[model samples]
Target: MKTGIIGAMHEEILLLKKDIQRLKTEQFGSREFHSGTIDGKEVVMALSGWGKVAAASTATTLINHYQVDQLVFIGLAGSIQAQLHIGDIVVANQLIQHDVDLSRLEHFPEVKSPFWKDFSFKVLPQSEDKALQAVETFLANLKKGDYPAISKEYAPQVHLGAIGTGDQFIASKDGKMRINERFPQILCTEMEGAAIAQVGADYQIPCTVIRVISDKADEQAHDAFAEFLFENISNISVEIAKLIL
Candidate 1:
């Protein structure tokens, strides 16, 4: 089966590209596609850049142009829950757009657009059971020698839960705490997963997100992100690709 992989930043995609043998390059609507293989699994991959629109457009291209059967979004996220630390993995069971707000019309919390009323979108209707199971299975069965490149004593902890996606980078402690309080079910927050999830749902294609916790919601987050992400992202990507493929 053909699988499409998308990363939100150039740094996230660079290592994966190094391992893959680039077979061809194609362009669709100003976006470039790189066809390749990862761990002997035939795949097409690209960096979707930073936010919702870019992610959605890339997902659409992966489905319509690349003709991939499944899509996997692998990247980093900020830990919303206090217990989660840098390097933990979060497999999204559901995705929420924290920025999607329309509480002005004497109504309960629900999605709304300026032009439309009561329009809401729910991501991952079934809670991504198969993908979550795969992640759990992989984590449970991983061997120390399986990946020597990563120095962590144990395989990363994989939590199956809600992942909030929005356009803003979650660098503020107050904002992070507020979101956690409002959406107690959420474990992590990132920029692109939900948008891609929405597009995948629209096209009826299976999609899953695997996010590595890069920082906790605190002042240390800003200080530690660059070094933490550079060291962990590639390793995280390899593990997620193994589970998905």
Candidate 2:
């Protein structure tokens, strides 16, 4: 079975690409896709860019051109829940496009943007199981000193919950409050997961979304974001990929 692994940035997928044996690279939709075996598992990896449209297009291309049977997306997200701090991992059980609003339409006043039934996608059970297992394994390795500690006092915790997706990068306190009020169960906010999930749903390909908390969705969200990406997120992603693959 071929698995299509997607990340929204180069740092997220760089180490996984290096792990691929007998790698082959190709370009499609202005994105580079690398195909090879990781731990005897056939996989295709790519950067899906940074928004719903880009993610959907890349996912569609992977499903259509590469014939990937399943999809996995890993990236950094701004935490919406106060309990979730940076370095914590969130395995998305469901995802919603929080920015979608059809509630204003005269005929569709009953359709509530994020609350609408069609606006959400549930992760496939089997795929979620695999992802959870991989995360648990990674955490175990961390405890065994195979990976670096998340912090002096904090061991990264895994949370399974709803993740909100949208085009906007939530950076202000008001933005976080609005989304939290709208979707209280949402653990984190990011740009791409739900869109790819929608495409996966369309093609009947199972999808799994795993995100690492990079910043709190607040006024200071962008501060040190780039440093966090390079210093921490990439290595965590590599460990997860190793277990998942």
RMSD of 2: 2.9
lDDT of 1 by residue, 193-241 (tens): 8888788777888778888888885677776678777776776676656
The sequence of per-residue lDDT tens digits that candidate 2 reaches over residues 23-125 is 9999985999999998789999989889999999999989999999999999999999999998889999999999986555758766455533467899988
* Every model: Cα RMSD to truth: 3.4, 2.9
TM-score of each: 0.85, 0.93
Error of 1 at 205 (Å): 1.5
Candidate 1 clash pair list: none
Candidate 2 TM-score, true structure as reference: 0.93
Can you list the residue pairs that collide in candidate 2? none
Model 1: lDDT to the true structure: 0.77
Evaluate all candidate structures by whole-model CA lDDT and list the values in order.
0.77, 0.88
lDDT, residue 126, candidate 1: 44
